[model samples]
Target: MFLKRIVYFSRKTLHLYLQSSTMSTFTSRINMVTGNNEWIFVDDDDFDYNQELARSAFADMLHDHERNIQYEQAIIKTIQTLSKSTKKIHVLDIGTGTGLLSMMAARAFNQTINSSCSLRITACEVFQPMAKIAKKCIEKNALSHCIRVIDKRSTELDLENDLQGDRINIIVAEVFDTELIGEGALRTFSEACKHLTIDNENLRIIPARATIYVQLVQSSFLQEFHTLKNLSETNQKIKIPDGCRHLAGNTIFDLNANEIKNYIRPLSKPIPVFDFDFKSLNDKTNFTKEKILENIQCDYDGQIDAFVMWWNLDMDEQGEIQLGTIPSWCYDDKEKEENVQWREHWIHAIYYPQQPKIVKAKDQVSLYCFHDEYSLYFDVGISPFPPKSFTPTFLSRSAVAGFNNDNRRNKYIQALEKSFSNTSINRCLYIGDGLLLPLLILEMYPNIELIILQSSNIHLAHTLEEILTNSSKQLNYRIIPSLDKENIDFQTIDMILSEPFFTKSILPWDNLHFYYLIQQYHHSNIKLFPSKARIRCIALEFDNLYKIRSPVNQCCQFDLTPFDEQILQASLNVDATIEPQSLFEYSSKKPTLSSIIDLIEIDLDKISQKNKIETINLDIPFNVDGICNGIAFWIDYQLEDNIWLTTGIENENDSWVNYSKQGVHLLLKPIEIKTGMKLSINAAFDFQQGQFSFNIIS
Candidate 1:
């Protein structure tokens, strides 16, 4: 019997992997062979690598592969929120597989009263084969008059061309992966917000918004599930870092996605959730330099290995895994996917835990433990009194003592030189989204290319499209976008500009969206028509496509564009802070300043959830070795250290919540500056604490 074989191609030659045991030796040349070869042997045909690459296309794999079911929920949900005016709305669909949702939107528009204007849906897909199939699907659905599929990558969707007409009122896409940035989302959403939006008019993304959440949990199904073999070697002790769980659980961001029978093990920890709306495109474009949220407290613990954030989006009311359609793309070939569920190729940050410990939960009773590739860690018990401090032994790759082997400045210079020599493009500067850090780097890289980016703006699409359509086009070379992130790109690009989040957004300025649309272009290989005009940047979005709640009022209805700061202030006044925690250290054992909880003698893969963790607490005036990357840690600091807010005389009437953090001593230094202020300050030496005291200025 002929065994089932799956075939696909990258830049290399074709690979044929058998799904079952009833297979034979793999051969590719096509020559008439005699019968009865141990395995099935057909004609031998030798094909060149270039020819093989030409033959490779993801169309068939994306369209006809019975692995995924098609869903139209995103379109339906989008239509539900639209009024007669929103009819014939311009819709951009990114990663349009089979054009199912796009077709639905077109059909709905044809039936809407506000259909006087042409209803358009721009669909983008990279794989030539898949894009062709999507067109055919659109035709079959009788949506050729409205739905247009452009088989291009998101970054390639230039705002100058594709976005030149009337701005799109909505965007729909299925660009989310485990970690939002992993699936090339950074470049996709960023461009869309910059160049594809409606001028002054409001646009929507199906599913309205997306919420990202992270939590710590325990799992033990790993060992038995993996089908262990080399018992002795596998059981040997391994070193893991503090605050790291051996088993990083696998789950889908799609709310409706299923959980397979087998689950990966993980340690339980408090979960952090961040939410964003598409209409609010500022956060995704924010850069690292000027928009820095110092000690933003991704985690509360002192020791932090990394901040791994995942994203889940609601495409439509049906919660379509792909832009509000029926769940399809998220699924795997059940018959063949017994070993894995879903995964994309990408890398994120790794901020490991600090040595020793800072603050541990004062109420916990048991110890928690886990391990990373480098060291073992544990959570010790809380203490009511002061403890002796010591130097720390860091086993993790954190910002610890000697964290950097070489000077970062020198490395930056070298990289700048290399990029200039390679690209033959000099006077280059690197810019990324941040509050204040990137600007500093600009001064350092001034001799080369100059780059400046916003920490809260998603305006790279226009600039990117200019480069793509002008320079050799490649989606990988564009600025990345996000809903909650400041900025995140897939493949590294050139200089960055101001972020869209904190900076004034494009929506406030009308008529610019259409100008951007006019500047779009398609990739060279595939000559997809309407798709080239498709705003892959804006067309493939899911947030802010539905009910738009102002960022100020997380739960309130927010339709007015350019959300008012006063509303934000009002939201802050009512938004209560949850359980607070400052820098924390979680180890299976006790945490002391300069102490290390080494999980050296532990079997990482064999680690079970039942293994209890240790915890230690701190009350007053103390220091610890370890740190936590938890939200509680940040909120606590926000409230206690006076680091989260500040006030000036001009802003005395403005009792605003400063989203900024301050120094440790300022926590309780409540200055009672009266109407008129005077100064009579003096500086004196305090030899004991090796510091000077703060004199009052009245």
Candidate 2:
């Protein structure tokens, strides 16, 4: 009974869980404007749903030809090796997202033998939503007859009941997290070896093994993403307090490793940390319960600020098929020049120690990694030092890091410095969410009483209060979520500052939370920092960007015609969500066509309760010779009379601090255009809908 109960989990399901669990936490209320008939209820759940719907993970996996090619080769190899047996082929797929692996197995089985032999698959998914979707995906590809999705987690499957008393011999799972052993790969394999598979010694795993590698580095640029403004810098040397270096945190995000070389200077060569064999991990249940420690001697002496990590996989038994996520620079010059496969699904990891350690070239230290089946954490101790117990914790440090490095923050600081320089405007009022502007205004104008309008994000409100109270030099300020307009004297307020950012804002224009506050004092003479702003757009030829949205008709040697039909039908009901991306970070090889165009220019200092256009249309003519995949948009703010903050700035000569900033709207399908073509864009900014729509008049 125990032999029939175990299963495998795919990398796709792990990606799904990450998306659902990492959504931003936001507070909401029904905000009904004077002119708009629709009441806006900005909630986190709805925002998260929209965000997930907008992600093209399925399409991205489909377009990843290298990943598919490896999986196909591995599946075919496993099938061919196992086909010598007269016994039926029994397989298990864990975290079966979109049923891609199951479909691959079904295709492999058909190619290996005739229909007389039995080939059965038990695709298990703990996420019911994905299970239903995977069923449709498998059926659409005409593999439903051989593959059956069991809407249950692998741990929950009963050998006798769920598996129908059959033991699985072929386990194809891609449950690896960025940390490799993350996502319970070890625990899942251990359980499978104990209960799911037959007594056969040659049970096959898709990824035969994975090895994690790490390198130490001294990176001031990477440190900014972890520490806030308290760590000031002088002449490229940061003054990070001793207390700030004690907590090593992991930065888990998609990083173009090759580009990271510009910011980080390596202190040591890549060193292998540990390796996990998925085929025989039954006795390794302790990996998920406690810390796994490794001691390594320092090869170079430097300020060890971080340990950069990456992993590579042996996809089959023969090791002929392989996939690696090491940044391009890690390879020699020859491989760097080659067009290596760069994937967004997997990237490098950074382990920032609890305390940055200084060591000599011959010093030794213990690097400890801990996990609890779902996620990973890391810590380090000096050589001969006792290993400390490590427990997993999650915080919104990433959010803080983002605010610290945001290009908008630099613009805000500049605006505040320019505004308060020898000016008579004394009293200042700050409205809207976010930390950058208020922190700057207080520090620069120490004497002026700055009144800040806070929101329901208690963590942010408390953090701000604590930061202000602990400052060596305090400023005159009042913080509250709302003001009693009836008791306030709007006439005395001389300056109004707003980042135009709100936690509840899911769309770019939703920052109008600032505009809503401006409406209260329209009759007053208060000066607005950003007197005007506009939503701008430009046509672009995003080389492979659109493929993430629409299914590629031909992938490898397989045709996704039926899958494309499913995606097209679903697109009718599921409107694409606009996600913020670092447009500049994409490969330089991709091309952009046409000039930037302003869609709607709004006067921030003025508000009208009488007239508003429900829809606005513009005929944009273009003469570009490129594959027009989509339009990229961003907000351009007039920070001051001559000062500007444009999120869409792409000028190489521009002296502004550059960061990733842009929102994209991919077309339903790519359109080909020559030099003589014109594009008519019809757009509507609907305040009632609390969203905007753009369509090309073909």
Candidate 3:
């Protein structure tokens, strides 16, 4: 009989289960906030929810294109960019969510091979439900032979000494949200690199860099997450975050709802600020970038939403895994997307020229930014406020914003017409947002080569249908979804084309954490909780991956006309995915469900024991939003997680161990192991002064 299950679990769940499965703890009063009005907004320990309502609401989000599918595209793009070595290549997919990355790598390899070369893809995800779903998809696509999904985390990639041996050619994960600090990107990526990146053997990280642009805006809708709202004792409010530290050099602000709405202060001119590279990054390392302008300016004041960026990993000669190359999206591991949850159009933090940048002024100020890893500053002659312009300095919508001058697009065409005149680039591929822009370039420049990256049609096609049909046509260029159900655009887009979306999982540090939490929260809301005698499956066209009987609710309400046409029709026939492993195979294997859960339970027990004895001093200068400056981390002790996760930074260094002036802390509570408890932690570092992790004997 099929049983109902959840995608993710909470610390409390893990804690309770680890303590004793027989205990079966359940909260009497569940207060889950539905939206801004229902923002319990803090630890779940205090909030409760109606099981049915929570389940129903969550199921809706699972299929929501605006929310969940965006992430699907992220994994898709990350996977599409990965390489499958000519020889047998070993892969490690962290947070394998539906095994998208694993499948992409496997598919790429299998496609490139003539049947002799084989590749293996192993994935680690702590969420059992997500693992199961991934396993299902992997098996459905017949990838189970090469890709194995483990319900564990990257930190736990080291198993009972069995799953270890050869280093992986790729370690792909899409854990980062907006804020770099939230997604445990630092910890997971570092751990994976150390474990997988042996001496000189190369490995490719999907996103080589995550760049964040900091801009000033005027919006009060996002004050809650941004932490810019007024704190009141009666409202259970807290101090606002560093969002208001505007010209004070606090570039990135992890805002909340109220902060988003209350932010009316405007520095109109778009400036190029803050560039963080994920590659070659260290806990305490420093770097700079050169002349980047992802941030933009609008005609009117608006909330700083996001500065969209994409990955561009350079491959070695043989195309085996190689590091050191930089992807386009670079952030200082700062900033996030969820900080503004209400609006769906798009959010951005623009950086315009002008020192004492004006709130309102009309003048043409030539802002030349020398943004680099070593140093960053701009040459702004005139420009009071960041400035008010209808057109932006950068366009992150998609491939329209090419990585280099060669990307065939209208901007490049304009540049070409002005600079190269008749000369144009040869052989070009555009990845990430902005398909129409390239088409415009095609119309204008005619001679340059063009390639478009469409991460996922199942994700955008639905919305794209609505978007394309409703939005006014500015030009002849139109990115219409194809008639096929699975593919997006089959015939290459010279003036127009779209590739199935699939790329890197890693992101800018701020976005890494922020969006990670948002995804978890959103996923929790959208997870397909299986019901008894029933199975839940992604309604992939042609062949639905549904089970006959299950207990969980299976439903999603989102317009998919765009996705269906754009993606499905793009392909004449939808190819089946990997096969699904039996529930028995998943739960009964040697290091099977019980075995893995048991290991996690043991660790959870240790954490519970430690938690009971001693609690972290949240009063100390840190929180999920981030830690206040002037804080130092002390390595009091480490956990036995077989990773750097064991190491926790203390506010001060003990006499024995040396502490970094600025270090990161794995901000998650000890793993909680309740069977159905699911929660997402917004862990952050205290920077100069903060502490994470705790241990004590009661």
Number of the top-ranking candidate, with TM-score as the measure: 2
**Candidate 1 structure quality by residue, lDDT tens digits, 351-399:** 1222222333332223332222111222233221111221122111111
lDDT of 2 at 21: 73
Q: Tell me the tens digit of each residue's lDDT in model 2 across 321-416.
A: 887777666777775535667555555777676556787787777777655555555556532212342212222333344456656666777777
Error of 3 at 283 (Å): 2.5
Candidate 3 stretches greater than 4 Å from native: 1-26, 30-85, 114-116, 159-162, 198-201, 218-272, 285-698
* Candidate 2 lDDT trough over 10 residues, lowest sum: 1-10
Candidate 3 per-residue lDDT over residues 1-698, each given as its tens digit: 01122212222222134343333333321211111112112223212222211221122123323333333334344444343334546667787655656766765665553455556778886756446656776676677888888787778766435366766655666554323334566566666776655443355565444443333444332222122122223422122223221211313222111222223444343333443344455644323224434323444533333221111222222323322211112223334232212211111222222223332333333344443222233334432222332122122211111221121222333433442333233433333333333433444444455433333233332333333233232322233232232433333322221211121211111111111112121212121100001000110111101211111222222222322222222221211111111111011111111110000111111111322222222212111221111111221111111211111111111111110011211211222223332222222222111112222111
Ranking of models by lDDT: 2, 3, 1
Error of 2 at 531 (Å): 1.7
Any runs in candidate 1 off by more than 4 Å, and if so which? 1-74, 86-88, 113-117, 220-270, 283-311, 314-698
Q: In order, what is each prediction's RMSD in angstroms?
A: 30.9, 7.5, 29.0
Q: What lDDT is reached at residue 597 by model 3?
A: 8
Best by lDDT: 2
Model 2 ranges off by over 4 Å: 1-57, 110-118, 125-145, 231-251, 259-261, 282-303, 356-366, 382-410, 421-423, 485-489, 588-591, 609-611, 614-616, 619-624, 650-661, 687-690
Query: Compared to the true structure, candidate 2 yields what TM-score?
Result: 0.81
For model 2, the local distance difference test gives 0.64
